[model samples]
Target: MATPTAVVVGVGAERGLGAALCRHFAREGYHVLVAGRTAEKIEAVARGLKDLGLSAKAVLTDATVEADVVRLFDEAMSPGFGRDPSDLVVFNAGNNRQLDFRELSAEQFEDFWRVGCFAGFLVGREAARRLVPLGRGTLIFTGASASLRGKPGYAQFAAAKAGLRMISQSMAREYGPLGLHVAHVVVDGGIDGERLLKNRPEAKAARGEDGLLGIEAIAESYWHLHKQRRSAWTQELDLRPFKESF
Candidate 1:
């Protein structure tokens, strides 16, 4: 069998883990699509993949919009990738607007819901529509611990991601009969990004917060889930560093 293709949405230049996921999948010979709102960032990630002799493309998609999601799925299924709806579709795009409940505004709440749950819904539905026809595929959504428990200060982000978890389990049950696997990954660790590198040098220095679960680790878990048989399908997997407590 040829390498299965993957489409990763919600890529950001510096903050996103999606870029790393693209590199991982492409290295495995999958035709990867790096899609997000930033074209330049996506292109830069794709360029790195090309330099490494892998197939990848940069796509600009505002996942919050239905039309953009439609266009993305269309391009993903084009002849460039052997005309297939992706064997793996990952909706890793999320916007975090964490604010204390007392200080939170309606707009901030909406933003979180839109980017977290709405975007996942948009991407997941389209992936399901295409994969049902193909009769087998993997659809995974990235999640946070906040999604499972709405913390005191981060109500908005918690609610939205919680919605994604519910959606994932529901979709998993709905499509499992057709060989479509749906899994939600709860990334229960602090992500190490440039912000931590610059402002919180002490964290980088002292190895605080367990230094963010490496994107490669998360990507490998995705691959493992993808290869699982129907008899032993998993619905949710929570990932945290050794130093982090559950």
Candidate 2:
């Protein structure tokens, strides 16, 4: 029997949720394929995981590009790698730029959709192609509050995330009976990370103790989603800080 393999897209920084997911999956004994556009960052993350005696490799990729998405799966299933059809695939690539409704350009809106929705479709389709035959796999999409509601100045981000949410739901219905688990997770609070602290110091102060969402906790939830029995699969889940309203 081959070891399970996991693919994680959009591993932006060490402190972000994507990276956290990679670490958790790696610790669980899955050979993790870290996919992202930034070569340096992804490689650094892979190296760190390797240092911990975990199986990990960096696959520099732009998830928004069809060619790149295709290449990503090819590399994962390549003979040399000997990775079984990805046991877990996560579509975590997202573009969250706040633009006033009036200022949001068609191109900008499409860009978000390209990363947040189209890329997910590409990855999910490929993953299903492989998993359907084997009769098992898990696909997870990282969503946000925007996935549920559109806020002012976030027209583009909201639209894209909403599209992703629908895609996850549709896939869950279509593939659940085929032995594949598809889930969408909504992160509803500011994640406690260096980037968040640097950008919004006041948010940290306002959140109080355990007010910010911890990336590790989020990763743990994702692991739980993957381990769920077929009889009780979770199609969607929402995570937020204790202080978050609603």
Candidate 3:
């Protein structure tokens, strides 16, 4: 049998959830494609996995672009190196920022939508087009709490994420019967990752131990989702810190 392959898009810092997912899949003997908009970040992640004697390579992908999304699937479906086409794919591309609704410009809203919703749609569509034929595959989407709730000063992010959630739901309904496993993960609470730590150094201390979501812990849930049996497939899963309120 050819080696199994996994593709993770929106990978950033090595300490982030995306990188953690790559590492976990690599450890499971899957050839991982570390894809992201930043060449340096993705390359670093791929290099670190290689250093650990795992199979992974960096694929520079701007998930928001149509052509880039198409190209990413092209590479995933034709992965050589004695590996099978990607049977696992994750669309983790998105950004969040608090912007007052009254002051939010059209450009800012569109930017958020393009990244969080449009990109996910593009990836989902391509995955359906390719993986549906094989009759088996896993496509996971990384979502935020904003996907379900609209908080003040976060109109743009909430709108975009809510749309993404809808995309995942529709895909799951349309593809589950076709043997494509589509799931959405709603990540609640702040993640204990490089972005949060670097931006707000005090956040870790404020949240306390286990207060913030651990990247590895989050990645493990994704692995479980991929390993789930069809009879008990989960269309949506939520992860959050124990201390988190709802």
Candidate 4:
């Protein structure tokens, strides 16, 4: 049997959930394809994984582009990598910019939808194309609180996320019978990361040490989703800090 492979898109930041998920899957022996727009960042992540004696390769890809998304999957299945379809594909690409409806321009709104919704569709479609024939695989999308509700100053972000959420559900229904596990995860609270620590220190402090969602904990949930039996697949999951209000 070919060694299992995993592809992670939008792994630009070292401290982000995408990188954490890459590490988790790598640790479990899957040859990881670390993909993102920034070559340096993706390569650094792959290098770090290699340093730990895990198999990983960096593929610089802009998920928003159709050609790039195609190339991403092509590179993942190349002989140099695993030469097999990815057992797991995680679409972590998103743009979260808060803007009041009056201030949100058409360009800005389209940009968010292109990255958050369209890009995810491309990645998920490619994964489904490859996995359905083989009769097994896992595809996960990382969502945010905006996926479930639209609030003030979140018009663009929420609309894009909501689109992604619906797409995830549609894929799950269409492909589940074909043996693909499709799931959408909504992260309802702030993640414990450099961005959070630097920009929202007060929020983190208010939430207590464990108030922020741990990156590892989020990654573990993805791993769990991948491991679930077909008889009990989860179509959607919501994760949040205990202190976070609904």
Clash tally, candidates in order: 0, 0, 0, 0
Over the full model, what C-alpha lDDT does candidate 1 score relative to the true structure?
0.84
TM-score of each: 0.93, 0.96, 0.98, 0.96
lDDT values, one for every candidate? 0.84, 0.89, 0.94, 0.90
Candidate 2 backbone collisions, by pair: none
- By summed lDDT, which 10 consecutive residues of candidate 2 come out lowest? 76-85
For residues 1-246, could you state the per-residue lDDT of candidate 4 as single tens digits? 566789999897788888999999999889999999999889999999999999888998999999999888877656363346588999999878678788888999999999999999999989988888889999999999999999899889899899999999999999999999999999999999766777777877788878899999999999999999998999999999888899
Best by TM-score: 3
Instruction: Give the winner by lDDT.
Output: 3
Q: Which residue pairs does candidate 4 place in steric collision?
A: none
Candidate 2, superposed: residue stretches over 4 Å from native: 79-83
Report the C-alpha displacement of residue 186, candidate 4, in angstroms: 0.8
Residue clash pairs of candidate 1: none
* Candidate 1, residue 17: how far the Cα is off, in Å: 1.5
Across 36-143, the per-residue lDDT of candidate 3 in tens digits comes to: 999999999999999999999999999888899899889899998699999999999899887778898999999999999999999999999999999999999999
Candidate 1 regions with alpha-carbon error over 4 angstroms: 1-3, 81-83, 195-199, 208-211
lDDT value for candidate 2? 0.89
